[model samples]
Target: MVEPTGYDLLLKGGRVICPATGVDGIRDVGVRGGRIAAVADAILPTSAAQTVDVSGKLVLPGLIDTHGHIYQYVTGRFGLDPDMVGVRSGVTTVVDQGGPSCMTLPGFRHFIAERSETNVLCFLSAYLVGGLEGHFYPNLYSPDGVDIDATVRSAVANRDLVRGIKGHAEIGGFARWGIKVMEMAAEIARRAEIPLYVHFGQLWGLPESGANGEDADTILERVIPLLKEGDVLAHPFTRHPGGFVNAEGELHHVLQAAIDRGLTVDVGHGSHFSYRLAKMALAAGVVPHTLGADMHGYNTQVPEIPAPAGTPEEHADDENHPFKGQARFSLTQAMSSMMTLGLPLDYVVKMVTTHPAKMLGMEDSLGSLAVGRVADVSVLDDVRGRFVLRDNEDYRVIAERLLQPAFCLRAGKRFDADSPILPQAIAA
Candidate 1:
């Protein structure tokens, strides 16, 4: 009798949904040698060394987070552990948004990316300071602080890890330095030939002298022309100024035009999210292409890590400060938020999987469950119940269904989804 050539592991009888590959149905996934061996309607249980029944669960291409701040210890108290926000949270890949600059890329690569079980990537900071203390000091992010040539060189030199360029076009920056900083960021992204991811909410406090004749409502128009087709406009539903909505509470007309011009949108859903604003934007047909949890220390209830000596202390009285030390959130919760806002489950899945892969320009390797691809899969419990979801502003909505991560496979290795930061579903 001949021995059966079998897989190393198999996930059996799960509702597999791979949007990029156009597959949505019950399937069995076989993994061997750290790649997808097969995804068929049914593979005999005997065909694998080990098999786990996943009936009534969702099996998808591993989730990818487009915005994360995981430069732990180096960025004061603002960064979280990569694995805490990655595989342990049922996400396979995390793109650290603006955490590493040219000066810090080497440390980021060696200490953060290589040492972690989860796959880590970066959006090189356009500024030299590079997410220091979550970009807290307004003076450090000025136009004069950007070294375009150095940033471009760093991005090009580290193409394997750096996917895009991260910068801001918010009201505070506009009031401080006008559009010079954005122009420099655009130039760096252009030179590197990668997508530019721009934040569109208030990141810095305004100058004491006020708006300086620069209006928050007009910031998008000025920045849009500077951005190329593949550039990203993030924080569409931010409660802060300089987001997708204009001063009159209407969706900015220029937003549709930016989309028409091939620009992408990302829901940098953090403490910035507002359900009311999300509804308005969705009603105006401005769906985001990608969804990111934007998890960092300030907005999450992380184990307290004392800031390094001489590090700037967090001032508690800032009126615009996000709720600190009290909330638990994850990318799965962001997906639930979209569903609560009436986006179909399939579309929401795409926002975290396929769409994010495309945004990272990693289509061939990361987005699909096609055979021969890396065996990075996410298994989720598709719970059906009445759950109450809330946002930063304390607005609430009831959702009939919620998707929670169960576990994930990264390069065929299993990681249980058990991050302490994962939010519990409050019964409605």
Candidate 2:
């Protein structure tokens, strides 16, 4: 028979990161009934059932990834199973961005949400067609794809799981009506009293040339008028046609204005969210309100696309090839990236935990480890010796130390350290 100790588990001798109160110190956490019952300077091992020595680790709230697409992209291609990538990465909660359209939400609710161990929330896509179809190709943007009425209705009906509305403004084929589509989506979100998350990148101009015309200023001009206080601007640092950087290599005024208005800016660091824009935006005083890996099928596997060497034949799939790099960055990597950008550890913790929880309107319920809050904790090891920080795809900086995960607790259940779902390699 399996041995059953008295209490559930105890994590002793770890530096705890409490973002809300800015508390980082050596502490012991006790878990009972699948919830954090106590956190203090020290707790006797005899007070609990199982005890794990986390002597040189960091304890924090289970990372909350506000933006991701686990269901949309399949692994080795674009998508990833949330439980495998998220929970094992020390993330207990994941907010899927535009994965399900208003029409296909029920499938997500039944097939994806109900079955996953990680807590999955969704931002309903304004497009009625949703992600079940292929990538947002030209044919996908037809009138039939966008059903504003249905989008609003679905959002209202599923307020619990559906948090916001999502729309994409890319340069390739759907650029012409990208701004208009996003505006319509934002209006619906406003009507439903929920935030609208817009993907601002490239916008297509006139149809004949098939070239991206509108710059970042033009793209922001269209959406700025429609943005509300809680609306989110996802991937604020994409380096395509219209991005945060101006032709003069300076931060645009509109980007600053959006931040000034309390609009939540997110770092949806997918394959295209290059370090250049991220570094510039951070320097421009636009701290990411939320940090998301934007993990999807295509981007996850071949995260960075190779530079065209006159033709496609020049490109070979080398493991070190930056373009063919896999979208395997964990939430921990996102935090560590911010740290590389000079963000304080406490502030980094807030971006993933408290700030994102607030943006999702779940601050009272999630994002913290205070008594009575859900027991979601991530324990990490502060690796003092082997710390090499990388920037963009090529740059690397040797640091004195790094923070990595030791273990994670979701609803008081102790999960293994090497689980594939959590981002523990950096922690390791």
Candidate 3:
């Protein structure tokens, strides 16, 4: 029998934190052949082909972003490069929410999933047309636009890539077709046997089609009952009308009921995140299950690589257009808001790892560092300083505990966190 040999790589002396494994302390993680070899208090350096000392840094399971947009080429100005928001940002797996529809799944698979160095999956859009231009033209997202038969067929055919269905239950669309659109989305989810990921807030761009229930407070009352267990309710902390927070600035009473029934609320923290509403939701016992950075061409603060040669800037001069890129944020930036709200580091990490992993049915492979599991890990730098942070509501707070990505290992391959989502990190 061949004697025990060295590992492919070893991360030594790091404060490894993985709530899924009940591990929290200094340890040495060994990886070989793209799988976790061992996680122990200490593994001699001689037993590894490569070893990197990670003292004082956080070594945890690779981060999983439950909601992200990276449809590039196809979406024109609304998409971003997958790796730009994935490995480059310290995230190993990113779920592309609403970027691909029945008609565009082929392009998504050939262009994104097959090409990205980072693992990319999808929550197939409810509309047959998908999130073209990130839903800039709301009429395309109308109930009449959703082809239930085609959407269900596409989702079933792409089960490996399609984990759930994406839809919007906002006042804009609701005002036009009432709850019919949401019902169609739920029917598609039911047919596919996958969860429906519903985004809340104002997504309608057309003129109001008369009050078919425009009051934001009454949104949950209509949609929550329609949602089956495991469905995701995104953007609970949105400052916009027709979200979790009511017009009176209080948590909608039905929010808790949905949570109790197994409805997962994801923090698809976008340009609409409101620290003020977040406080109210927390006080009312609402907590985010997944921290998703709804990063896209419009909300991303990175330098615009601009449209290709002849692509027109439909709303280039319109500052408020949803596709106009602006704030500089990433998955880590979105989670900072949660940490600033007083969540412990260990559990906050779980929200992005274990919780979403299970929701996507990828728990066995993606969220843990257990022996024989895929060797994907994230190294974070927990910095302490009085840093001023702001929310989409213009509210600001000074945070003493900030978590930043140092680097990550995807299937045992080292990828440094060099994303320009924040100030450059001091060399460690």
Candidate 4:
């Protein structure tokens, strides 16, 4: 007869991978009162009220998506529901990239973060307009639109939710404001004493008169100096201009120096991702630290907006928009892309877990299954077979292993990976 043990739940026989604790084997995790109570080779089923057999599945610390855009409704159609991309997609924590400005952060905290099941945080936008219409209006993002003092105050006051600052560094912005916007953003980040996450690919359309002496290849060189240690350079493998790959088809010479200067990289794997550029960067020894799906309503399938007569939507076709009919995406899909690029599975796992935790400065509370920590765990199905992986450029590769989210426990509450936007793999 087994003595009564006080575990509320026991996850038995799962291949647990917690890089932070250096555990990568079969283990039984015991949870009590929403925290990890024990992790051992054997935790008797009778010791817990509920025992979940997770055999043949990969159990890991819950995923942390570092570049989510889940402001919802307020950011127009661009924002997604917090839970849709959060716990429902097997991600325990999501850091919304540039969704809430200092002015709109209060609503984001009350409506999105406070009420959500998953942990929601933000890299507060430098622009006062925030992510309105998906940053569609490029005119609103000029330096004049940024209030450095107010933004700094908001970030300081809401240190609990605002982890960093978000700004852009692409050619379009450079041509318009000539790096003044970045200068202001850097100042705000400095005052707040948090990292600044800068977008490094083409976002806004360039000025009608052209670059006006602005060069895409030189954007990184100019922007890197303004950034300090712990600051992030996002979208290194972007298909768009002003990324790690220069116009000459070679990796930028400044990339190594930037990384050496304690600057980190994030694979903001959005529609801008390019398999070709990713390969070039990998060959050039530029590996990103964190991976985020960067999913929003525009990239994935969402309700079609009823536009006014003769708008771009009326004439849009698949040819004009290459990614229109592509497969849906998630953080798991981003991990698979890295795996296909020849990165080790464990390394890819670290990108979504430990690396993101460090990026958010919440390593102690998030990203690990250490005993006494919150019971945030992810269960993934590591399906081994030939599957087709495609990028924004429509480039495809055959991958032998694909990781799919089975479920996740967020603060001890279970949520299945049932988001409609979860990708369905095509046979190779």
TM-score of each: 0.96, 0.86, 0.94, 0.95
Candidate 1: minimum summed lDDT over ten consecutive residues — where? Answer: 316-325
Report lDDT (CA) for all predictions: 0.89, 0.71, 0.83, 0.89
Query: Best to worst by lDDT, what's the order?
Result: 1, 4, 3, 2
**Model 3 Cα lDDT, one tens digit per residue, 308-396:** 44223664444544444444567876777688898778778998899999889888788899988988898888888777677655588
Across residues 303-394, which tens digit of lDDT does each residue of candidate 2 receive?
33332233223333434432454345567766776777788888888888898888888888788888667788887766665455443354
Give candidate 4's whole-model lDDT.
Answer: 0.89
| Clash number for each model | 0, 25, 0, 0
Question: Which of 2 and 3 is ahead in TM-score?
Answer: 3
* Candidate 3, backbone clash total: 0
When superposed on Cα atoms, how far off is each prediction in RMSD?
2.3, 5.1, 2.8, 2.5
Candidate 3, poorest ten consecutive residues by summed lDDT: 419-428
- lDDT, candidate 4, 127-215, per-residue tens: 99898752346788888899999999999999999999999998988898899999999999999999999999888878888999999
Supply candidate 3's per-residue lDDT for 72.
84
lDDT against true structure, model 3: 0.83
- Tell me the deviation in Å of residue 24 in model 1: 0.6
Model 1 lDDT at residue 100: 90
